[model samples]
Target chain A: MYVDMQTGTVETIMSNSDLPVVLIVEDEPDVAETYKLWLQEEYEVRMAQNGDEGLDLLDEAVDVVLLDRMMPGLSGDEVLERIRERDLGCRVAMVTAVEPDFDILEMGFDAYLSKPIRSEQLHETVDNLLDRSEYDSLLQEYYALVEKQATLEATKSSAELAESDQYDELTERVAEMRDQLSDTLGGIEDDSDFIATLRGLSEDDNN
Target chain B: MYDLTSVLEFDALSQIRPGSSILISGPAMSGKQRLAYDILADGIDGGDGAVVVTTGDGAGDVVEEFRSLVPDMNDAQLGVIDCRGDGGDQAVGNAHVHHVSSPGDLTGIGIGITKALEGLHNAGNERGRLALISLSTMLTYTDKKTVFKFCHVLSSRLDSAGYIGVFTIDSGAHDDQTLQVIKQAFDGMIDVRDAEGGGREARVLGLAGEPTDWQRI
Candidate 1:
């Protein structure tokens, strides 16, 4: 999928690359590097010390974000707010030492992982966020396919009604269009479910 | 059944009803969550089952609040699904309160709600007897479209299944457009504003087909 960073519009694109990208936005060099080391095997990892640098890396195909709550410049909350303002397509998990209070959770971090992070917690949070991102993308594709299918069904019904009206030549033309639309819609829907199931399986594997 | 008439200010909740989708809009310091707990507490005291899907708060916190509200209320009747821990099926006995890791997982939220409702129903509870308390933490991290769709699906399912769905919204955090969309989606809405003197006040906006027997807390 191709996401227009400026306009938050997502478009489907065929590309050879298949790895999901993860962006780590932590001010602490050691923490960011540790995350990179942990996640590099499964994802294309990128690191940014602050919110500004993280925003600069927004152009990359980032699927998940590991954000630190407290930073020297541009705190994690500020960075998250900016990311939302930009409508970036990445799931964020707030990694912090602060206790997971109601106020912190209410701030809208997808998942909250406290500092002194265990390898299991880090892996699970990243894996779940990626799974959700993929599922959301698949849902969008499914909705688009369903919309196309509904349009084709309507067109096909109209053509059948036209046939009853003795418009033989127009009926043939409409019938061809209907067939093409049905085939496209059916193929897209089938492919969408396949991809969605694949993503679900990958998520289960991580679990 | 307890006489709800004298227990609460009937005029305040005149717009609320059974099986209604209500948005308890308030500020962070305000008693939006407390009010939701009271509503569920009232249900449990009245022999109805309730399910709370916690997005921002922990199940223990919710249980503690309920305990404060109704100290003698049986914990068995109240189920809380905490989506704040690692994704696993951790139930607290018959209550069926499970822990979920992320708000981004709409599927998990949906599944948790389904399981909670089923548990309530299996315990001999009738339709219109279960209440859904979904704390609005997902609104901040997720996009408007995802939140809107999530609310849509949740409201639709609850309405069809005859469950009273009560959710919270932070008026200070969201824009006018998003707030308006959410208002249109719910069957009932309570605008909890700080009163001039002190405390808070709730204004009920009743949808066309909602019941007229909702009382104020």
Candidate 2:
């Protein structure tokens, strides 16, 4: 697998612009400018008139992409391929007029939108993807702590674990994250404790 | 409530409602796959129609295992969506068997599930139990983002259809970030590991109070 290991997150990325980065890759200058105008308030919008420009603008700092599929030189599909190949870890939505076909099964887009999409749709999609990315960042940190504690438990002697200040801090961090997650998860049912959090996540996606 | 005593073989989670998606994450040899199979077979034992989308194992072998678990299993109801692309779709023992050339054919798998559910319902079972043996294999064919969407899409489908779903993954196969992202797609997750006391144990995550408490299996 070409999956890169977890070292940093999109949220942790530092850039000159404080707002999250949104890349718009459309062939039509008018459409690109429209998207830029709509998103510039909330995001640091970067316009790419073509696929090559899109690639040039893409980086780890980019949180989401509004990709046009019918570009001339390099299609949106190819740009998507290049994005994944580069492993930028950014969410992409293929906003195109093209009706989806069975071949979409093989495509790696996070979401698909028809060309007649409204501004609200764009905002909702971008917000949802950003939320997902943020949650993923927290989860990564949580698991990193849990795994660290697990490794200590597996390899260290009881006395060693008790004596090590590092181990003690590790345990504390896990507890803190558990509490944070619980607060985020809301109520838990006896039968569906774990599923309940998933329900919360689903709700978060919607709202 | 659907009884899970046959699956967990303990009281940690004795009953779970239908339409819930559970993910089991554990490193190699942690018995996660075994638990997944147990959950699916337990449903079959109780006469719920079962579907297995096997990407790593052969369909014949999977069928044999299911039969072994529930002897005199309902042959007409079990559905196997073999994505190994080794053979064409067919009916074996009057069971609904569908094949997609590869795991990349997500639409085919989706269609396969619809047919499988219909076949089971036509055979008189009102509910279905769906299990994707492992997502690690699916991740190999696509990026983490796409895999995450696939899980959400599949889970939502099962939820509306009122079916139970269980997906599994190998912990050591992917990075921590990948695991974290995919973990959000399900309603709950089961983390399996070697118990300090000597046997295998599991703890459920994504819940309130003491959700990480591990129980021996």
Candidate 3:
């Protein structure tokens, strides 16, 4: 195997302006700007006045969505539904005044932070969601592989997995996904533990 | 021909091939981890870089145990992943010892494993091998699905790099379904058992061109 045993992490090619994009979709103008003020230094911030405007601003480029759950015209829940329907992979944190109830469990938002949000809570929610989002696709692929492996194990033998081309392709795809995620997340400073772990698992795919 | 390491020392397989993964499973007190260390020691002895990911013991303790078994072992030949962090204070403070946040942080553990492998590679060693000690401990931290996914990604990475990936698990700790799901990802299995005469015996299954007979270890 051809192994590149140099530095573990491939430095993320980053400029000052290349921060992760965050979209604030609060109907309240003051609240939206407050969020912008708090996050603009670290993230590329965008503001949408309402749900309709939020939908217009929504895209793959948006890394996170600070969604107000109860808006006047189009409710935050409806907008969240739309976001899910569109399969936009952006992390959504339901910023709401309503105390969380049993029904909130059915929602697809990555996090649910009640209203009167403190700066610390907001920052943490966004950061945690963003970090989770980095591995979302990889985790999906991993679960898919497990499901496939389970099905194969029930009907077939270990030799089959070793011999099957589909299995090999899935394995290769997973490795590539991990590498891609690791490469993308290589920028942030505090992920020293993560970077070190990635380096430990590194091996040459070309061989 | 590549040596099958301590496995060959026990059962004497002719050749097991690179890029193949093996599960060494037995009862709790069957010395499964010791067998894993022996395999890693063989790789190290052959000048193949070794990556030992410990989800159970601290790296220092693991290294100490390894040195006890193989007295000539050199620290340079091995890379350690200390996943069993006790929180607050750091367990390891060296380049060779990469610490993950915790055993529950599978993503961090994944990253640590890759980084350790890269370290071995940068050290000018070409043929690298990996060993993950005790999957049972990993099972304690997360759900079966997560652990299964971890193994899938990890084994796939090892396979693409043509590194022999070895892991140990207690056969009694998991149910049949769990064991079967975990076993599907590996190329073979070495089921070790304590014989009536007090010594241990092993049976190899699904390894490329290897015998499936129960051999005395």
Candidate with maximal TM-score: 2
Model 1 earns a TM-score of 0.48
lDDT of 2 by residue, B1-217 (tens): 5667656654445566666788899998888778888888888887888899989877777887888989979786588888888885333677788887877666567767766777888899887788897788888876665566567656656766678888989999987657766775667788899988689888876532357667787
1 versus 3: better DockQ goes to: 3
Q: Which segments of candidate 1 are over 4 A away from where they belong? A: A1-207, B1-17, B86-93, B127-136, B208-217
- Each candidate structure's TM-score, on Cα atoms with residue i matched to residue i, is 0.48, 0.61, 0.56
For residues B84-133, write the lDDT of model 1, one tens digit per residue: 76654433434557666676665556556666666667776654333334
lDDT of each: 0.62, 0.73, 0.70
Candidate 1 Cα RMSD (Å): 15.7
Sort candidate 2 into its docking category: incorrect
Q: Which candidate is the best by lDDT?
A: 2
Give the per-residue lDDT digits (tens) of candidate 1, residues A1-207.
889999999875622257788888888898888888888888778789888898888754777788888888898899888876665556777888877753443355667788899877888778766655554554444333433333343455655645553345443544454344324323112211222222332233233
lDDT of 3 at B51: 85
Ranking by DockQ: 3, 2, 1
Q: Kindly report which residue stretches of model 3 are placed more than 4 angstroms away from their true locations once superposed.
A: A1-207, B9-12, B87-95, B209-211
lDDT of 1 at B81: 74
